[model samples]
Target: MSPWNWSDLHLRDPWWLTAWLVVGYLGLRALRRRPGAAVFYSEVSLLRLLPRTAAQRVGRLLPWLRVLALALVVLALSRPRAGQEEFRIRRQGIAILMCLDRSGSMETPMSLGDTQMTRLDAVRHAFRLFVTGGGPLGGRPDDLLGLVTFTGYAEARCPLTLDHHALLELLDGVQVARRPPGLGGPLRPASPSGLTAGGGGELPEASIPSDPYWAEERLTAIGDAIVAAVDRLKDAPAKSRVIILFSDGEQTAGVVTPAEAAQAAKNLGIRIYTIGIEPNQATLREIAEITGGRAFTAADPQALQDVYREIDQLEKNPTEGRLYTQYRELYGYALWPAVGLIVLELVLSSTRFRTLP
Candidate 1:
């Protein structure tokens, strides 16, 4: 909203509006001035009895027509214009990629101030609020957002997109890694004859869990996740490209180290904001500093949401939103009408409204 937007009539030359006083004074004089008598007679009682013709009725309005023309001319001189409308031309927004850890540690029970849930669930909730807007947080409607999840390996869950609904839907499906029962924990193998290895005794039964997909889900790969996010954001067509890395553990499995990935992002003019969930902050802080971003530690779900809010404040739209007003010149409208009225006054005064001096 701007000052000029307050009114629809924009006067380019407001000083000309003062001419209205002169026009009014001249109109008053014209109204008060009497025309000289065209003819004089000894007796004039017959003239009062004569019927008033249409020309005579029109003739009385001639002075008023002159005054109206002068008013229109004054309006034209003021250079009145119509404020068409106010609008804003918004520029492109920032591009952000969020990398989240899905390792077994993320499944630890956590409280979100009001309710208790897994750490992964709390992260999802906070992310939803950050994207869709909630109490104290404005949504990232103008930004292009993407997601990456990592454990032993990194996976690109979604590409950069403006459709937040789809992005959130994908985020809802991310879950903590569940290890297979027979694979990870302690295991006791019985002999082929159903006897203990040490002696001829009944072999203790072993409870073997039945899932194989947990191996990759049990280890954290912070560096690999950052590299994957950098790949997604390096070519993004935004002035400001950012990567938000969230992890509960240090880099446990990845070909490239976190520092190397951070250096790569810095080379491409990208920032990486690291958020640690009850983990050592030294590596996270180093990564953030390398990429010219910040590091945050979330002790609880509320603190995690607060970290996201702070990031939201830090990354505003790259382009500023500005309001502009466009005005359509209206002086032509007044000027033409003024000219027509003047011509009409001239014709009428020279003919039907004419009086002898």
Candidate 2:
């Protein structure tokens, strides 16, 4: 906020200003026209020959002091307040579910802006910008944001919540779904060591790599992700329910098809925004059209941000405001000066400046 200029001060009762002018006129008139008592004498010039007393000289000016005090009293009656104009916002936020793909393909890097980042990295980074704010999508603090991640199957990572900071913490921990064989992660065992512990006592090298993985986790399940997101949002408190799905691969797993999921979302009045990275746009577009939503294709990170920017605009909820204006009472400003001026008048009127009969 900038400093308040003179224009920012508004008189709440401007009609009182007419009273101010009236009082000023009356006070000035009394000061100028009030006459002193004088005795008419044939030799009045001889009276002037007498030296003027200190009290008489000072006493003559005290009427003007009273007039000045009255003028100040008039000013204080007209309340002056500091006024500000702005949108006083109290957001009734939308409920949104972020459907993210963490399949192995996301590990592949793509060029974006001046840096090269993995698809998953780009998506996560862009989304963090969207959530915490500082990008095209200002932020979603008002919105309850949830997260759903998919690989071979979909999992709800977070429930719909207005606590975006906690959501971002969860987002930071997300990694590509499956670490391929020979690479060690939660799913796969560490690289096979030459030593073995089975045969009675002495260890022997393993003949075959332990089963590549317990389950195939690299496959994409687009339909399952969408369904999961919709399920979470179906009972959300807000009327503006939305699902934003970010994926790099087409459906390779899950019992439901993307088309069927889109129809279910449509029936529930949930809008789904689909972002596909270097994939068949036809499927995404079809899903979007069915759900009364839009499909965006992001070739690079910059393109991805633009797509989200567009979604930010489309998904915006009508913001309602409850205005809050803080007013510093300028009455004190006038009141103090008025008080000081009146004190001065009282002091002078009682001192050497005192009037005498």
Candidate 3:
């Protein structure tokens, strides 16, 4: 793999080496054609008085040094390369479907930095770091990534894809189920001014769960989110399949239960990592345990980011290649020496080898 290993040297364009040979021949021919130094000395006896210094002795080799430099430059033009050795490596990657719950509870704002922000907003920022790629997470470029969102019903926001930009756009749209200005169990959507609720507004009677016309289908459906996540990751080609569930509340709607979904996930060899974001019920832990996966809890923005980082560490793809190749460029070996020799030759010619016009 070393470019300096002469035995492993290879020229990409062997034809360029012809330039080196031609330069060498021309250098010798020029030496033969050049006449001996001539001076209009009145007598040869006067030359004996001049001392032959070390610089003058070294100047005699300047022409040879220039010729060698030119030859090396020609060698560099051929673009030499080093040996390429391939070795086998085993790489591992997992197909992950991020199942996020956008229930109303996510509207709970906590201190993200100097200011307060909603859990959903914080989760979105964490998602951006884990998916769009920032530090530590480096992103899952090799693995296929997908998004599944849920509140009362689960929606596949983006199918498993390598295109992170499109996925990020979908994540950006995921909003917490703000109580539609009615119920007190969960906060409603953020008002234009801020996420805080109206001026001590009383819960309207019609909006209660007991109300016959009330739509229960719009509550947190953790089970259904798991189901959708499983559906998204079932067909992935990666050896390892994972689902990261982010939820804020217990399941209120959805045909299948989280337990039932967990069984299905276990059968399909999919690991479900559950993340509870300011959760109301500890349901995520139960689901994670059932599915043979770990559960994480994030109470704030920084914690949510840290949870993502931990998951990133746990689920990232393993080294996948059985064979690999390494190469080094050797042009520097020739090019640098040529440059040094050229400089030395120029310095010698200007100093010790100076001639009168």
> By summed lDDT, which 10 consecutive residues of candidate 1 come out lowest?
187-196
Q: Rate the local accuracy (lDDT) of all candidates.
A: 0.83, 0.78, 0.76
Q: Which of the two, 1 or 3, has more TM-score?
A: 1
Mind giving the per-residue lDDT tens digits that candidate 2 earns over 54-140?
A: 777767777667667666666678888887766687778899899999877788889976788999888988888778777457877
Measured over all alpha carbons after superposition, the RMSD of each candidate to the real structure, in angstroms, is 8.7, 8.7, 10.7
lDDT per residue (tens digit) for residues 1-357 in model 3:
334467766888889888877898978875676546566766878777999888766766667888889889988899888766677766555798988877656777889779788888888888889875787778776778899888767888899888878888888887765434443454343222222234445545433444322344346667778888888888888899988888776666678988898999999999988888555456888888888888888888898889989988887578856555566778898999999999987876787687655
lDDT tens digits, residues 1-357, model 1? 333433687789999989999999998998899777678889989998999999888887888888998898889989987675556767677999999988777878898657899888888988999999999998899889999999878999999999999999999998877655445454332232444435566743442323424534555678888889999998998999999998877766678899999999999999999999755678899999999999999978999999999999999875666777677777888889888988999997887677887
Displacement of residue 222 (Cα, Å) in model 2 is: 4.1
Q: Model 1: which residue pairs collide?
A: 181-209, 182-209
lDDT of 2 at 221: 72
Instruction: Tell me how many residue pairs clash in candidate 1.
Output: 2
TM-score of each: 0.64, 0.64, 0.60
For each predicted model, how many residue pairs clash, with residues at least 3 apart or on different chains?
A: 2, 0, 13
| Preferred candidate (lDDT higher): 1 or 2 | 1
